[model samples]
Target: MLRETWAEIDPGCIADNLRAIRGMLPAGVKLMAVVKANGYGHGDLEAAEAARQAGADYLGVAFLEEALRLRAGGVELPILILTPIRPDQVELALARDLTLTVTGADWFRELRKRHASFAGRKLRVHVKADTGLGRIGFRTMAEWDALVPWLASPDIDVDGFYTHFATAGQVDTAYLERQARRFAKLMERSKASGIAIRHYHCAGSAAALRFPGLALDMVRIGAAMYGFHPARPAPPVELKPALSLHSTLMQVKRVRRGEYIGYDNAYRPDADEWIGTVPLGYADGWSQRMQGAAALVRGQRAQVVGKISMDQLMLRLPGPFTPGDRVTLIGRQGGERISFAELAAHIDGPAQAITTALTERVAKMYANAKEVRCPWNNAYFQQLRRVSDGSRAD
Candidate 1:
């Protein structure tokens, strides 16, 4: 690892999380493990392999390239793209056997014009119905039916039909019920019109946990599968978190009273205190708003007390801590723990964004039966090793 900071991916935990979440699903319902955004920055290939090993019925991603990466990485499972694909990318998607999201009839026509690019291979696709979210997909039944002729064009195959809920995890169920009804109505109408879809899914991680009825033929799990859903009203099914961010406190310096801590003198030492410089900063996805947020140092809370720089942040040590001491940015250090919710709240955002924002500079270490790199000698790795070995890490 080039940087002291790295994200540890616990495949065992992911496997456990998938098993727990899958138990809550209805009989015959499948799971499409969402590994988009590099498995939410936990390393896509590693998490995909883990999820597949844990009995994931399918895999999902946002971009066609992500599907290509998985295919290249020896993932031969059925993969679907959650987002719509560009007309130009359809050829590659067909070549790689990646499923495309059919948003509208116009997009379908564009794909047909380039149908010859498929090299005689039938293109697999999924129909997306925009129930309530004003994001993408067809809003009305007419929009969905407009593409009916193309569904049987022999150039494309509509393997799945799905929709997304605008509010699934919220306390209110009125809107959630409406979205479900709309999606069901549209899907039934399609069936009545002779559109045969192999798979039908609507629930993401939150929906699958909160509304078990939406577990149609498959449930696309992303955050919940990784165990990072810190939203209100926690999931009933207990999930093991699969990712943790950690860094090494490589420098311990004694700052005199009234001395500035970081950039622009944002913090001043009240008294002569020992400060540890953590070798991670905003550039590594540790946001600047995390200045006041505390990390774990030697099983104690170390409050961040300075402006976060591009490559470093300052932490007020609880006691005399030495260089090479471990720091927990989003995990447990002894009894103290820093959660994704806390970090997101510190930045006024959602929990999942924290992981996706992590850049490629931060190396990802996977804790599976198979090991790679084995770079760090930090406490996090030691704990991960124990956990991967089927012993207790926490």
Candidate 2:
């Protein structure tokens, strides 16, 4: 059997998180699910379907290639490419019918030259205003304001105006308010120039929860859909975690006292102990520092007792552990569940310890999609759904 080290995505959780976000937004304010960073390291396509089923009006990704991938997958959602696009990719963007964040005329001109057919097509566009974030956007209010005429041009469809918040989820509320005020000013300037940008989004997952009513036309949600909170507290809503990391014990051996484990002599058996080696480690997204950390062994805590090698880790059980036992690295063990935030905090950072370090070698399995036999195949999702629905017995 293939090693059990993989990220498990629960599609049902995606639907639930979107429902929570939609309930918080004002009625008619749109919801755009941001599926960037491969859906924050949880397979993007699976998360995208979950978000869509949960009532997302639009989908956002960070790059043109990502948007293209979604389209190639037969996903027909209206996707907004949040990154500023180069002229070369504009044709692909047009061919794929993607909404791109426009920064200046040179880039737009390049698009116009290649996709002359765009003159007839309604190219939905969002202007990226650099309202103090100083990232990819129009640098000045005047520069942004001047785009109104082009935005209104019959050739292009100016659908939205948005700004990113540098402090929305990480800093003081007072600072966030200031950034919001700047965004408001930018909107007013756009209005004065007669550019009726229909959608105005300025909130990410962090801002959406922290600044509740600030959902202008729509809110962009990324991490929240995967069941992670945005640094600040959102309105009270039942949030379900959508991802779980798991593995099975590959071998169980009795270690003599003073025996070193794995590489570099990182961990030694405290006493004569039974150690279960699992096929998981830094190569599979389990953190190297998790040595001396804990994994859930059949709902009880088992301490990781060795250096996390590239493809495996050792866990010391208080008693004898069998080779076939299951281990939970990021899930509930009985009544106790390990949160990623908690896992990250345990190793001196956010539970980003594993998710952030997830390598491409690891496979992602979806419990809600059609199952395929391969490690990345999601065919078993139907079986999982049936079990969840009580249609099939365990």
lDDT of 1: 0.82
Error of 2 at 302 (Å): 2.1
lDDT of 2 by residue, 1-394 (tens): 4455556778898889899878977889889988877777776787788888888889999998888888887778899999987877766777888998998766666776776656467777898877778888886677875666567778788888898887775756777788888888878888888776789989987788767778878999876777776333444576778888766778889999998888888778667988888888776677677777788876778888778888888888867766656677888756667776667666776443356578777666767455642454343433332332112212
Write the residue-wise lDDT of candidate 1 on 1-394 in tens digits.
3445777778888888998988988888999999999888777888898898889989999988889999999998899998988988877777787888888889877766766435577888899989998898899878877888878776678899999988886788899899999988988888987877898889998899988888999999998878877658888877777778887777888999999999999999889999999889889888787889988877789899889998999999977787767788888878778887788778887677888888876767766434554465556455543442112224
Q: How many backbone collisions does model 2 have?
A: 9
What TM-score, over all chains together, does every model reach? Answer: 0.91, 0.88
Cα lDDT listed for each candidate: 0.82, 0.76
lDDT of 2 at 156: 83
Which residue pairs clash within candidate 2? 344-349, 344-350, 344-351, 370-378, 370-379, 371-378, 371-379, 371-380, 372-379
| Model 1 spans with C-alpha error above 4 angstroms | 1-3, 116-120, 368-394
Decoy 1 TM-score against native: 0.91
Report the error of model 1 at residue 43, Å.
Answer: 0.9
Q: Give stretches of model 2 more than 4 Å off.
A: 109-119, 230-235, 347-353, 376-394
